[model samples]
Target: MDPKSVRYISECFVQPQYAPEESKQPFYLSPWDLAMFSVHYIQKGLLFTKPPPADEQENFIGGLLDRLKSSLSLTLVHFYPLSGRLSTRKEENPPTYLVFVDCNNSPGAKFIHAALDMTVSDILSPTYVPVVVQSFFDHDRALNHDGHTRPLLSIQVTELIDGVFIGCSLNHAIGDGTSFWNFFKAWSEIFQAHGNEACISQPPVHKRWFPDGYGPIINLPFTHQDEFVIRYEAPQLIERIFHFTSESIAKIKARANSEYNTKKISSFQSLSALVWRSITRVRRLPPETTTSCRLAINNRSRMEPPLSPDYFGNAIQTVRGIATAGELQEHDLGWAAWKLHEAVLNHTDKKVRGFVDEWLQSPFIYQLGQFFDPLSVMMGSSPRFNKYGNEFGLGKAVALRSGYANKFDGKVSSYPGREGGGSIDLEVCLPEASMHALESDGEFMASVSSSN
Candidate 1:
């Protein structure tokens, strides 16, 4: 009855429907790519699915998997970076050689066909998704640029008696959330169209670029596989989704605006502020503890000259809100919200431009290494991306999941719910004790409409 108890039926590689005209070519990965070496594939992976009607049977999974594989096959031709492999640039020079995607050697992405005897409801009903979200992965060198074995993208489709589950993992060195959803929208477009269209929703841009005065690529600090993964330390953390209704958000927004005596306060600022304060209180950290909240800012629009909307690569820069535990817990939601609002506003064009320049000089390492800190939380994944866009003729996704990698402590992902209503889902991953306190915190729970 549990999804984790699901059994594997078969596994195979699903290469591009047609190999690229260009082979044996290596695409450059910028300094931003190297900075992400530690963060790796975990945050890049997500689980997608649709609810099953009562009449659907288990055997239908086979046919559905075929459709997924075929659709992905066609999709990979356009999203070739996903089907490629990472090749290390063994050079010691700046802009280290470890930063590139080698398309010549690797075959297509890995696709697995699996089955779960349990119904979808059994797994979907939990407040926190179980460990099964990490199961059925193709662990063959997926984290590094070592060989031709790892696919930049690996997918698994697990068949449940009631419905199907799709797990997709993308290599961070080659792409980010923007790239993932962009590809997804296009994939669903062509798949739903039954391959009748010649052009994809948007052609991908694979070329990596740098500002005129920037030079010398930044290399990752660690070269070894075991050491590389160490940067992302995992703790015994559980995840839960807190759904805030439109009314709740509106109320928070008003309060946040009133706190600053400014009539303008965005929904994201208010909600994120509340989360920062609530978590700070629940943890009951020392008054003098240094606390911070990091916003996942996209460089696409923030760049001197904005990148193409279709720019396909990692283009995010994190800006943090600094505070003391005493400051956070003592403030009203509006106070916390204003802190977040000002932190983001503090980024100037000169500062945003300096991001890459500074990274190349002394690369900005991913914070996953410091994720265990008791006084910080990295707020990421904007609700702007249409998470519910890809219908694929199977109805919109009932929900989308970041899977397990993001379950690391101090990670929080916020997204709009599939329902068009102004509701938001704040997926928080914290230790069991902290989660228990958060679950019972009345002020926090008062704003939450549901947790599932």
Candidate 2:
């Protein structure tokens, strides 16, 4: 189908069904949230076969849209902060900006109804991700900072001839992958129960996590937008989803462990090591060139006084495992996985506290493209997230896809496979040539059971 085939039907702000008086106060952003102020918005989407046909197709679509929008409103009651916009106040002395969620105004989240003339196979069976899929999202080239004016969360429900795609554009400053999926799960629960609040088993915790002595509002050094150098322009690349079956992942983990003579190698670490090595080799960088794999680690349970699993905000840190290209290429998969395992193990509670302390002392924001080197890989989004568990009445999601928000060469997003049982689907973005080379590499293709 043509990329422009997606047509918008309706758009509006989806407010909470009932906003508590406490939600009227400005929601303070934590240091973790402020650090991601300039990063790209988190864009994720789910695909499901169309609900059982109705007498009139247009009426069916209308009914589906109403159900989604209404359930979203009820979900927002618990996630009220998502309905708010980012607010900022500038101080002159040192040229600082105080950023927080303006919950008082509650601008509300954006809900869009769109239609696409395509089949489920057109998306699930594609060799490379369809460019038109990017159009499903609300904000194409937006950053989290755009939340100041735009909705902190935007949901676009695109009706397909044979399927439906529910896309979300969430401000990264407000939450991470964990928080994003939790909100989605809650919405799906409400929608599945025909908009019943009793369906929600565990409500999300809206209280933001902050280090002691730190604040609900964090200050940034930048006085003007020009001072921030975040660019959404990504290098030309091809994106593909590689799926590893449960058995394949087990084989990979066993191989890594056997090679390293240890049983501690995890499935994720092994998988990460394989991708890192393959990408580095495909790039064919200099032997001495330094290549790193940055892993986004969740700090909820790692904190001294561990934060709740339901904490609804950014609580992640990107920890990097470094090695030279020569070393990585020469070493076995077990060696590389061990390095990543060590990196993850080493991020102890003390280290988490140290990072918070350092950030509190000298607050600095992350600039887009600075998180990974040109030859590095950044693995984000966890396979542990229950992607397929979101059954919005029709059935479970058949496929998971991401958008053009924070994409870059070597950026990988992991999702739980549709078949589950410890399987993983990695959405890999890489330059055209590098992607071509990766597809031909036998060592990498061996672990990948399928790709699209």
**Cα lDDT tens digits for candidate 1, 334-388:** 7778778887787766887677777666655464556446578878787788878
Q: Write the per-residue lDDT of candidate 2 for residues 1-452, one digit (tens) a residue.
A: 56448999889999999987868888888888888877888999999887666434667777778898899999998988999998889999988788888876756999999988888898778789988899899988888888888999999999888888999999999999999999999999999899897788668888877777767767777788667747658899889999999999999999999989999989999999999999999999999999999899999988878988899999999887899999998899999999999999998889988998898888887877776667899999999998888877668888999889888889999999999999999999988889999999999998899988
- Regions of candidate 2 where Cα sits further than 4 Å from its true position: 1-4, 52-57
Which is the leading candidate under lDDT? 2
Clashing pairs in 1: 24-104, 89-97, 89-98, 94-217, 95-217
Cα lDDT over the full model 1: 0.71
Q: Please give the range of 10 consecutive residues that has the lowest summed lDDT in model 1.
A: 139-148
Q: Return the number of clashes found in candidate 2.
A: 0
TM-score of 2: 0.97
